[model samples]
Target: MNDVESPIDLRNLKDALEWQETANVKRPWRKDFFDYYVDLIRPRSSDQCQILELGSGPGFLTQHLLSQLPNIEYTAFDFSAVMHQLAQEKLHASEKTRATYVVGSFKDAHWQNTLSQKYDFIIIHQALHELRHKRYAIEFHKTIRSLLKPNGCYLVCDHLCAPHAMQNDQLYMNKQEHLQALQQAAFKQIKIPLEIQGLCLFEMNVI
Candidate 1:
């Protein structure tokens, strides 16, 4: 989706389902890591306040977040329909009403046509690395900047790797690379306030 492209196949429904189980097995560490992102969320002014989660998988983190911040409206987007189905199953009946699930890629040609509103917060967890093209990292942050409300937060929790390291099926960028990409997207007040294990958490604001 950026000026430089790499061909990679996205995960299908079957792979998506399997990945959920794997993430579950690491829930103890994963939950704490994910919680770091949620902890920084500011409470919204209304019950209808919105949150957008990109690459949401089976609602693991979303359900955990809803428990902490119960009233806000939420939208979960993932490329796999099976992930949405699995997320629905994981969320409580009452909590389900607060969420809307969409199946699509943020980098898709039609992505901009689907989103109609900006969000108070946009969160991504460990999914960025799966992007086939590293250059899309820059483009996707630009997309995110436009989707955020003024002064809203964009939080990303992902693994860091050597700058030149190559990983198939993933876009691994070192800290400097990440900063450069986010800055190029015009996000302000950028900071990496937390790091746990190999995961680095980025907090940037739309000004």
Candidate 2:
């Protein structure tokens, strides 16, 4: 967690696995907080719904979501192969399972060209802060907008940079920073209903 000039390489199997385990053990509140947000925004009906989870490390977010809304389709996308493998192992096979796991990053040169389907809910939890730079974060917000259906919603929960914090490789955006990016991406009805433990939860509509 030192102030390195680049993002951490989470592609390593050992490191990725260890990071997931350590976060679970050390940050129990993190799970509870995220679960609360997921429950607040989960689908309301048994009707089929499409969801896309970005940076789904170890499937923790997806699992919490499915536990609440068991009848929806879930797709997970992550850049790390090891993390994706871990997520696959942790997720169970169920009759309600309509899941797709893709090992790719939006940062890739032709990543948007690879995805065809849009989603009703696009989730990014605890991952946007690792975007490496502010510009990438803004671009990602735009990308998420493009991936959502007309009435789709996007959810984001991540650390917020303290005001006056010096610029570094690690990406952390405060409320205003995120608001600017989301506005530029054309997201409407943006809400930041919760901010605790130096993290914030955001929900916005694509329309």
Candidate 3:
């Protein structure tokens, strides 16, 4: 599928909310994905670890992370205003205090400029494909690496395209392609800690 073939228009308030609801029903294992993230980040739970989430649509993962890690500070970065709105509505008032929401698109390399602080953890869940093609993955990963603190972890979870899996080559990368991009971006200690429901979760550290 091409960029125009993207399934949802997150810019619209109605569309964004509807997509959020639909995603809940479609990806029951989403919580499992969130749990894996929690485990990976549990080591930093006691500290005021800074975290940034790229394409943090509607803050589902943000809410889960904040609830699990009370000491962590989170930045929810998304391009769509409606998405941030939905996320703000979903989060508790207490959770909102520790969270900062920013609106920006990763489609542009300059999107990194919007964030001033480096993070202990940088994450993206099922959203990198929104860059519209796998060709952009490496550059995007490089930007993510730059935003990370020394030895920071980048947790990427996204749909995969393989002969036996989702076949949208233009939108999703196969496992090998994903690994190659991370390696080319100079991410070290890369590991595929989880792959479930057609999604792969890659855990890697900044060089």
lDDT tens per residue, model 3, 89-176: 8788899999999999999769899999999999999898989888889999988888999889999999989765688888899898
| Model 1, runs deviating above 4 Å | 1-13, 45-47, 163-170
Between prediction 1 and prediction 2, the one with superior lDDT is 1
lDDT of each residue in 1-207, candidate 2, tens digit only: 442244356888778877888876765667766666556655443677888888888778777777767767888889888887777676667723667888887667667666679988888888886565666777788778778888888988877777544334256777788888888887778998777666678899766
- Lowest lDDT block of 10, candidate 2: 163-172
Ranking by TM-score: 3, 2, 1
Q: Quick one: ranking by lDDT, best first?
A: 3, 1, 2
TM-score winner among the candidates? 3
For model 2, what is the error of residue 79's alpha carbon versus the real structure, in angstroms, after optimal superposition?
A: 0.8
Model 1 local distance difference test score = 0.76
Q: How close is candidate 1 to the true structure, as a TM-score?
A: 0.86
lDDT of 1 by residue, 1-207 (tens): 434343433356677666776875753477776667556663463355688999897888778877677767889988878778888887887788888988888768758567779998899988776565567788888888888898889988777775333333245777888888888888767898887666788899877
Worst 10 residues of 3 by lDDT: 1-10
What is the Å distance of residue 30 in model 2 from its true position? 2.4
- In the predicted model 1, the residue pairs found to clash are none
